[model samples]
Target: MERGTRTPGAFAGALILALLLGGLFPALLASGAGGTPAALAVCVLVLVGARLGWLIGIGERRLMEFSFWTFTYVFLGLAALVQFQTATFSTSTPWFDTAYNDDAMWAVLIGSSAAMLGIRLAARGPTADAPARTPLVDERRIHHLAALGLLLNLYYLIRVGPGTVLLTREELWAAQVARWPGNGLTAFVVAVFTLPLLVVFIGLLGVNRQRTDRGEPPRYALLAVVGCVLLFSVNPISSPRYYSGTVILSMAAALGAYATPWRVRASASAFLAGLTLLFPLADAFRRQGGVETRFAPLQALTSGDFDAVIQISNSVDIIARNGIEWGWQLLGVPLFWVPRDRWSEKPAATGSYIAEQMGYPFTNISSPLIAEFLINGGWPLLIVGMFGFGWWVRRRDDRMVQIGLLGGKPSGMDWILPFYLIILLRGSLLSAALQFSVLWAASWFIRGRRSAGSEGAAVPGRTGAHGGSILTHQTSG
Candidate 1:
């Protein structure tokens, strides 16, 4: 297939790969690898290989990238489900249970359906304009921001480390045995999502790749690197592993938006949106099972109980469940409500232990925005902060749209929205909202200036305006 033609096929391929990489491979690897470190490495390789294969076969880089990220999020969800199922079936070692295989099958199928639907819609047309400048802030600014965020993250880590930190090295390693082979999967996801932007940025600078656009000046890549570093350093109380991926992915999207063309941006946006919608919807279906018993592996890994991991995973599951339920529940109260007792007990009972495994308050409440609001103020702050920031970013996006500096026809911000949403979904809505608002505001300012200039020039004798024509008066002689 040709380059552009490949986006749809790549989306389809990504959906299929997610199934094999997350669902099928996990079990197969478990059977063979015996939960050893080597097994984890092997599984990571398998996933990487699968992703590479999809990229090669499908013929679209953006589609391939989307697939990788979707796989990361979906795999994490699936792993949690697998752990939950193992709890009910048996407390046996290497807790891979068949109890929820049926559920697993359906989850895969449903997720695939949603992804396919999205891809089909996205595939129909070109994306918005691509950004010309990669979103880069000043180097000094980047360093300063990184330093501040790092300090906070370190302070938080110090405060919580003794009691609640989920150190992967210690947790995953055991006496000649290792658990949760999929942890490496998370690591691989982190590396894949984070590294590329740095490479692209560095290459753009006169350091690596030769500059093709000689007329274009080299912009600040350091700002982005620093911001990213700082954000990653912040010891978020949530699943840092998952959020780390989001951070890096967002960074990449920002970079991609700056560098890619408008049409490419549209394609990327359509592809990513389509891919991510799958699990949330499928998960809604999966949760319909009588009981959720997916925390066994986590309990076994952390040497905790089902209550701990369930608590943490429940928060995540609930985010999706709540949104979907609320979306549908707008019709009727009873329609959405599971029996009060059932609602209270099920997630709570299972989730309590899971929460502990999840490191609770840190991952759920102590994340960037969530933590900020709780520690400093409350939910209202969260709402206000988010809206304020979102409005600002939306404004800036207008600027990017006007200059055509941002790639493709879609706004530069559009391509980055998924990345933003991924990071903010479980985060403090306020902080995320604020940061994005700033971004959009910047874009808007540029757009506004350009528009004002253009309009002024359009008026007769508006020579005082920035781009007006000659002000010279004609001589009668």
Candidate 2:
């Protein structure tokens, strides 16, 4: 099917139906219970329903866009639902004490949906004129960079002590609290290195795929396989979900970029199924005594009973008690460069502050972009911020498409920012800013060296129809 072919009326109907089913089914199931369950269900439903609606409305044309929405809305929506049900089912000691009303929930859901839709509408049009294209850095340079990154990560792992990762769940948690540089710093470093490593790895995979497509020997195949295994093995064991999930999701997205639509759909379905079944097993790998059976594995995955939602809800409560920060929280992004010891006035990251407010000992929980915007300036800021975010994503994706980075073959250049885009979409402003800064610096260092001979090679392939090559790149998958 063509992109954006669904009619507005069809989209509206689908959205309405989704909202009704999402809200009504939960309410009906919980009718005899207290009102909180119903309220929580409504919030979960609306968020999820809106996401489905948007997906149906927009249709999937761009892999980055699809991945962004799926992660931000659909995945988070499911998590929210799981959290709500878990909270209501498991405890009477409200995780979030604020008034749980349908109005507030609807406001958040509708505002978010509107922002997404508005951005989509604004971004739709003919492709914009792109700037000059530069040849990608040579494979040898990419390999060298990959080797350097691998060595750095190895040094970091040794410095941190391999025992930290090898510990039992109880031991792991204890070590986590007492560990030097702390979880925040560790997470930051892991994120920073992972990006470039992924960039090189994906690039090599693309090159290898292109070579294979041309009936050439798969020279880099072994390197790609080994790199994949090493990257997966080196992930921080403490936070298995985020660390490992990021890598897995990124790889899937990279592959999806070069896949046919039907294949993308099938892969997505398989991924969701696998995630649901394996989530409990993965959670087991992080715990002290192996998996605790306090709740069923399926229950944990289905109820969104995970820590992320708890953090998000906790953030919402904190915002309700303390007024909005009016964007003061944003200073944490730029000021992150300064050490806290040197700059005592540096604002605490939103996640840390929310954790403190909730009296949680560990504060590494995620404060999603939605909660961040909500705490900054309420609905208006959220709507505007989301709109801007959508616009920016579109501009970036379009530019990449224009530069022949997307939609045909998988190239190393196409994977880097898109992987980061997934990260940015899910993280708070401070985290996003820090990660983006590192990625930008890495990109600068690893960027392709332009040579006169390579620059003129595109002349014969140029087409005036789209102001660039409308034909798929010869190197495309």
Candidate 3:
């Protein structure tokens, strides 16, 4: 593989390729009579195609462990495809009629293409000779963090009560839609609980990796398993399927970051297949009435496909109605620590605001990334924002590699950051910010222990320059 800067011609060619591929959306829309379903199908296809092209052309050099590539696959690729397919063929009707317009949809596709191209162009070239640091795992600190996490989990369970997770699917759905305002302290407690979980999760990953490397069974295996079960159980039992799936999937990505490429692929395929098969069944639980036993997973794919396209369309409508919020939507990120009740002027999450404008009962639904940016400041800001985002992701990747966290042996921060990409790319920047803050804090705390040892020692089984190991003895020991 070559390790040099990308030529200007190659960059231009890639940009051209993206534009041509993006044109497929408008062409498909025109051909399909400008129907909502057709527009959605085109969007999904373009998104998938753009992502695949990215992975093939640029991802290999960067190592596709937990980059924006994975984020695209989960949200833009899989989520969009399933929703489009389900809406097109399933017996269930869409949640609402979309105000589908060819012009708006085309703009979205164009913006998306520009975003993808911006990301590609901003990416740094290969750096095989870059200096690498060996990060030492502190088992003692990890154990302490895990214990703290357990306490937090227990506190949350107790505060919410076990009955919260024991509700029937119908009951759970009602609760979600109700959006009950609990005591003022409820939000505070929830935040406290969430912070520890992030720390504990990262700590467990570090401990597990160290134990495995030492040829010892994972010391925190039981704790990890229990934590996952509790984590998944708490959210999915009462909330949406995506919530629970996100927890499990991110955990899998973290744990499997160091696995063979084949293993990672196999695991991801199995996860997606399972999610597709079970999506309808989960929906049955969330349905307003009684439980739906006639689960048609294939048909369910089309069921409830209203969110993505409708939200994008709604966001466009919102900008026309009220003008661009001009970053007002992002105020929640900085003021996240302030409770909405106390801070009466706090802004809503972009997704929630869009949903509210659309008159939907559920404001917790998605607002696509492109739409969010467009609603902020139109195409110019969208392009700039996406390029900055891509640059940041690239920098994070480089940091991982420099810290000896890539190439089948990732440190805790490597696992934490990539797993959070799922949320970052999925939209609702405010929520992503809050979640990321906790994870970033955890990563900082658990990065590596400082020791009075030489940093030049080589890692076992891995060689660095001049026949020396890249990992220091302190890190290995």
Candidate 4:
């Protein structure tokens, strides 16, 4: 009943706790067995760490509650893995072209995440739990925020104009809409990706009471997630590659569910997840055209197309595909030890390339530590640089933190606007950077002023606004 107290849900809490704490010894015990042994050991450690963090409640404030959602998310991720495995059904289409299946997988992921997040809400069992002190945004505030974001998106849209109209002509757009994996759909997806911020803004306004009281605004917020999935399904856009819309939607779904009581949020998450996934699955069924461009990157690289190679290189890196396809390019390269032509697909290319370049023969290391060691200096330098940068950012301002969490003022906005801003900035912006800066500054500011009584104190409105709440979420993917 006290603020921030959580009633444990399901067996997950205990199970996660045990695995996190107990998995480490066995993992370390198995080290030095062989080459693959090291990789397996590391996997065990990371999985255990993730579980432990969930148990110990690391990272965010409401981690336990979020942990349940995270657990479900991992399941959905497994479902996606299943979809990828069954991709044989759609394999011959082209380029491992499985847009439809990928969409279905993401839908399963999105739907499952939404459903799992809502579980606590579902487990009301007999009686509704007392309402938690969830933050309530006034309708006016939501509308205002939404309007601001929409305006920003429109401004950016006009600033950039339509990119290469040939890339988005109506006939081509319509055809691409019918079958998303088509080449002509690339620019359109990029354009649509920009819409989430706007949708978030508009959706926020619609979700709030004030606007709904006047006459319900259509449930536009739902559109943002769906639109993002569509864009991601297209699979060919270069800017904002990886179509993280589903990830963003997942974040929003988690927060939205958290903002309300468990049952309601759970039901809503289920419905929304289903709605978001529908189009992608449908797109897959219609994608008879199949994929042909799987080797587009290799083609470019071999032809000495530096620019194309660079672009494809980055793309492969984002999906964590190692330099497998670049074979001879990495011949004699340490990390590229596998084969001149074999691609090592995994996250953290920074480390992979470093190993090959340095002649270490690419093997996985724990966390981003390998990459950290390779870049900005080796491990020793990485520690200092990472910590120093983190500390520096933490000392900055709360605006940055707020921006990182829900956007500068995401209370009533969609993702499209901010996403557009992100694109324009070439993805250089770091929400984490902002959060660290603000936290540091707040700590220093509060510490300095504490002796001054009221002067040194948190302006009641700010300190713990996002903390000490049952429904608050501090970090998301």
Candidate 5:
């Protein structure tokens, strides 16, 4: 079998290796052999090995897996180790060596176990035995998405003032917040970030399809323009890191840079390094009136970027005092379509609520999925919720990998949502809710799911987009 061809991989063994290596990575980072038993650090490193290794070593190289593990390894793992030793955190009030660290570590362990259970169970299902479905792309629709994307981006550019789009990350973020309730930024997301992304992927799929299904060339000209515009819109300097990451990584996946096991592992390793080293420097462009106090990459991990660990600890503390919100806090994300004016009694986001309780001057802290699950209904929900997420990821991963291998084509959701998840995972859900709402709606609108017929791919030999097997094209799964 081709190494790129689908393989069940050594899932069971991989998980064991992930635990030992993942736990070991952070302990090494903490202090060679070290003190405090480093319980939390162990849990985090174990998480990195399980979550990160699950994707690179055993995963099918799906975009969703990359997005999921990237959070575990980069944003969560490095920061945890950094804090364990330095005993510093992002909060104004100190949150180090508190009573909650051990308990929170247990919570982390429980939640991850539940998630892994879901992934394992899903992999055993009957559907995992079925052949993957193929979807025919509507060339006409690709044209529509491209036009729509350009129109929306152009309108957003005008509304925000053309020059405003060129500001630094922090400055641009400040400008968007200033636009308030009536801001045109959502338009930017729907168009610049997602729509053109579809244009490029759909265009590539069309190129590969000509050999298998034997079709005409797609509008490569339009794809060229859209691709260039997407680059301009998502430049690192002006856009938010998460949003920029979504677009750029999705584009790369569409090109097949992340399809094979070796490629996925290589990219995953590089990604981990980048998050540890380069992610801190990202703030160089993010701070207003920059150059305040620069620290090395390791020290910077204790800053706001790594606060998901702190936020989880904070969530655990909140549950002890106020108890979970029952289910009220969970309602806001699904019902995000309802305007704030429409739902007067809507609950604040879990992050904001926790920050309020903690008396932080800023409410823009992260609340990871585990934190959300705990806040919603405590341990039961955390277990059940992660299990559900795992099940869903496995189901989707199997399907998307199949699509990559057999069809060489994918839907808008196939590559997009996974990257968006990076932000959602590092989230104040209410803050992220509207953006996802618009993003999902746009994806649904041009959903590349085949309208009819079973022929979804062309021959797999061409070196079309990012120089990978055309069969796995976008999925590189």
Candidate 6:
């Protein structure tokens, strides 16, 4: 039954790949971008082939594994196609176009494709030095954490009012400027609202534990609380598509959406379709007072919606004029907690920095993972960085697969990292630094909370966050 269920999707995957490479590829070749047909072909094949490979079931098809391929294919691949076909670049700057334009396109294509190769390397790579995940749930500390979040979020809502949060993006920004108490804390405000996310999986842990062990009737009350608070605090009107998608997909994984291979392929397809067709439409209420754009996916791609490729192109342009930063710009990511007042010459977030360099009036554009690697040290860093990243991602995926084989459920960081990778992969590392730090910190806090409870009496979630065991994902309410 399971094998047959995958057949139709496999056929669908082949059909989609054919439509792209057979039909669209010919049209793109005839366009002005045909001037550099080789580069164009590599860009198209590398990008589209990634989606096809994953959909057809390559390697361990874990959720983060699916996400790595899907995000690359949609966010970078589609934009590369449009830019190559039209012979247009989104930078809108003559600043560094002095170099032939194919170079920028090439950098974007090469970096992304290289990362794909790196991901594949995981299969042949050595055993992980340490267990890939340490799943621990200190329900007590988590409740305290969630309580803290509720307090912070309620204070924000009361101060800014719920009306402000649900309003248009422009209005939300205005309210932040006018009402947010301090500088550099808006991300905190947003993070606070999504606090229920931390508890959802823990709730799922308890329920699933009971079901597997005792065969009791399932309870929906815990999940119900999670849903209510999440919706109240987050919505398309205010939260960016990525943030909302993260919360939604994480919740789904917690609900056991990736329990089977076919479901993995199915959801990956849904993600591809949604990102291509519905993502732009979802942005209609973003900055505008209300829905403004119709469901015009192609037009949205050509206009400005998918900026990952172009932003990577801009980073390339920066490299052309100024050379790679040689690991300087990236210094700020790990040290993101350090204030500019103290560091003085601390580099700005790459996206904003690149924007300022390009003289774009707006500084909030994307600077993708490819771009991030390119600007840091050009080809050397791009290859080493992406290969290492791909290897790491594979280790995590393998760990998840191991857990599934053992009939264990992940109820901690392992459950969330796949969703979190979405944010990390959509880079400008500084932009994601705070949230990343928060996750790491929370994992540590939970580990300590659990360890302190058992004292010298026991190890918490052994073999882990930074060692003793993967056999038990200790969860107690």
- All models, RMSD in angstroms: 16.0, 6.0, 7.3, 15.5, 6.5, 6.3
Clash totals in order: 65, 10, 5, 40, 6, 6
Ranking by lDDT: 5, 6, 2, 3, 1, 4
Model 6: pairs clashing at backbone N, Cα or C within 3 Å: 462-468, 462-469, 463-467, 463-468, 463-469, 464-467
What 10-residue stretch in candidate 4 is worst by lDDT?
Answer: 304-313
Highest lDDT: which candidate? 5
Error of 3 at 53 (Å): 7.2
Q: How does each model score on TM-score?
A: 0.37, 0.74, 0.72, 0.36, 0.83, 0.81
Clash count for candidate 6 is: 6
Q: In lDDT terms, how accurate is model 3?
A: 0.54
Is candidate 1 or 3 superior in lDDT?
3
Q: Summing lDDT over every window of 10 consecutive residues in candidate 2, give the lowest-scoring window.
A: 468-477
Query: Could you give me the TM-score of model 3 versus the true structure?
Result: 0.72
Tell me the TM-score of model 2.
0.74
CA displacement after TM-score superposition, residue 2 of candidate 6 (Å): 14
lDDT of 2 by residue, 218-255 (tens): 67554665466455544445545544555555565665
lDDT of 3 at 47: 70
Candidate achieving higher lDDT, 3 or 4: 3
Task: Give lDDT for model 5.
Answer: 0.65
Root-mean-square deviation of candidate 5: 6.5
Candidate 6 differs from the real structure by a C-alpha RMSD in angstroms, to one decimal, of 6.3
Per-residue CA lDDT of model 6 for 4-102, tens digit only, reads: 234555566656654664356535544445356335645555565544553435223466666776676666656556655665545433343424446
Worst 10 residues of 6 by lDDT: 448-457
Whole-model lDDT values for every prediction:
0.35, 0.54, 0.54, 0.31, 0.65, 0.63
Better model by TM-score: candidate 5 vs candidate 6:
5
> Candidate 3 residues 239-328, lDDT tens each?
555445555555665665335433543554454356456644766556445767886654554555324445666676777778898887
lDDT of 1: 0.35
Compare candidates 3 and 6 on lDDT and give the better one. Answer: 6
